[model samples]
Target: MLGVEAQKSPKGKWTMPPFDPRFPNQNQIHNCYQNFLDYHRCVKAMSRCGQSSQLCEYYFRVYRLLCPLSWVQRWNQQIQDGPFAGKI
Candidate 1:
């Protein structure tokens, strides 16, 4: 499950993480969140285009609306700090 730090405060808590240079520089984390967001957005767009709602509801209803979105959000955070720093 996603730890408290990766959560988006859907329940009114503060959503941002305290900055730490040792790890993610925001883009990585933001990209991950956006990836999930994109999937759901496509689902909606598809629905508007006459696709059945049941076709892609899995990502939004079963995943995002549930607790797994936050957990899937931590995919890149499991790496050690600075692993990608100053690479070619």
Candidate 2:
């Protein structure tokens, strides 16, 4: 929800709005993790419905700015090797 605005494009796709500059430094690590999870869910839901994945990019951009690379890498490894596999 960070960069998801209420506006829609002519094609009815949810567009990524300009990110609020205040958001990158607004959350702690745990909050960022939750945001990442929410982002994954958004992508999964959209893709399941055959919608474009463009809306999901906002979450990625937000997380990239907020999370450390180490945390992202660890979660990525978990997705690859742990129960999170095939879920993310």
TM-scores for all candidates: the values are 0.31, 0.59
lDDT per residue for candidate 1 within 1-88, as digits (tens), equals 2346433333333334334353355344444344445455665577679885445433333234333454554433432243422221
The list of candidate 2 runs beyond 4 A from truth reads 1-27, 84-88
Tell me the tens digit of each residue's lDDT in model 2 across 1-88: 2232421222333434344554555445655676677677887799899997778776666565567768766776676567563345
| Whole-model Cα lDDT of every candidate shown, in order | 0.43, 0.61
Q: In model 1, how large is the Cα lDDT of residue 74?
A: 48
Clashes by residue pair, model 1: none
Question: For this target, which candidate reaches the highest TM-score against the unseen true structure?
Answer: 2
Q: Which ten residues in a row have the lowest lDDT in candidate 2?
A: 1-10
